[model samples]
Target: MPVKAKATYESVRDAVNQLEKEGKEVNPTNVLNLTGGSRSTVYKFLSQLQDEDTKRQIKKPLPELEDLINEQSTAIITSLYEICKHRAEEVVLTEYETMKKRFADLQKTAEHMDLIEEKYQLKAQNFELQELKLKTENQELKEQNKILKDQVQTLKEQITALNKIINKQ
Candidate 1:
């Protein structure tokens, strides 16, 4: 509550206490019936009192209504501050929960990306291995072809030598 609000509430309490000291009951509806204040103002003052003096003790009568009202102002302000603090704590807790959930979601996404990268790396390694095997097989085939060509050339030279000997005879 603002300082002005607290001051207005203090004034209303002072008025009520003065009326009570003058042999009047400080009931909520009587403020309009006895005093000139409206019913709404009386209700507002009662609300301020309820908030300010929940467990407050009154051992002796107050000398002045102004003093009593001023004394209770601190308690009212303190209670209002406590209520606001609790609300702020609730809001902070709610935001913290939301942030925690978002962090968990991001962690899951990162894990999925790691798995995808690992799979791609495995696939690349497999392709390199297959290329190496194909290169080795092609080299062996070229070597075998060279050996077959040499054997055929040697057989043709032997046939030519036999034909020349028969013609000379």
Candidate 2:
């Protein structure tokens, strides 16, 4: 009689993996055929493999999902921040342009007011010169009027003296 080698845990696990690689179902029959184990022993090992697979499936995806969620959150936050910053810069630039235009307009208005003030100042000086000349002319006219009055009085006295002399003759 030929003696069969006893199967170990590593041997059964390798047999199951080989069967899966060959696209075969990892049943107790297939695992026992590869590792030369009893039906009951292959069944026990297969159950252990199934339990481990279930544990891996449960434990594996949580960290991956957390990483993916973190990446997506970071991207969304960065996009929102960029949008807000760009809008703020645009608003500031628009306000700056508007203020610059307003400042220029104010400067023009100030220049116009300055021109009006200079023109009025020239007119006031001209009026002052004309008033001074008129005052000088009035003073000369008053002096001439006094001299004419004195001459008229002297002529009237001479006429009275001639009349008296003729009556006496």
Candidate 3:
């Protein structure tokens, strides 16, 4: 739609630039008001600008933006889109790799925890075995002490009997 005939391209450009300078998103309706043109005229001017930008991109092409603009302008938007897409893909791949490495580290940490748990279990079992051995040894020593006490009592009784018999004689 030759936007140049209906609206002064310069005016539309100035309005859009002014809106940007004011920290506002340039809308077609605002551009129409700024340029004193109809909404359709504003849209045509925007398309024309997009077309020029797209045309400037002859060396490279972008796939997504190609669908948004005409084929002739596709080359321009395409090149820019390709550059942006390339950078975006690189950032995504780097994040994905970092996540994978962190996951691997977590897996290793879990394995290390499992190893520590096994060591603790083995040490606990060894402690229990030592305790059981000490208990058994204590019981054996008590039994031996009882037997010695009984033997000492029996020998005293025999000595007393021999003494009485000798006194009788």
Angstrom error of the Cα, residue 139, model 3: value is 1.1
Error of 2 at 26 (Å): 62
Best lDDT goes to which candidate? 3
Model 3 CA deviation exceeding 4 Å by range: 1-73
Candidate 3 lDDT over 97-134, as tens digits, reads 99999999999999999999999999999999999999
Cα-based lDDT for every prediction: 0.72, 0.78, 0.80
Model 2 CA lDDT for position 76: 79
lDDT score, candidate 2, position 19: 83
Q: Which one wins on TM-score?
A: 3
Q: Estimate, for each residue in 1-169, the C-alpha lDDT of model 1 and write its tens digit.
A: 1123223455667656876788877776555444445667767777778655643533335568855785587568667768886898899899999999999999999999999999999999999999999999999988988888888888788878988988899
Worst 10 residues of 1 by lDDT: 1-10
Candidate 1, which segments miss by more than 4 Å at Cα? 1-67, 158-169
Pairs in steric clash, model 1: none
Give all TM-scores, in the order shown: 0.53, 0.50, 0.54
lDDT string, candidate 2, 56-122, tens digits: 6445544677868865765676577668768988998999999999999999999999999999999
Clashes of each: 0, 0, 5
Q: Model 2 — TM-score against the truth?
A: 0.50
Sorted on lDDT, best first, the list reads 3, 2, 1
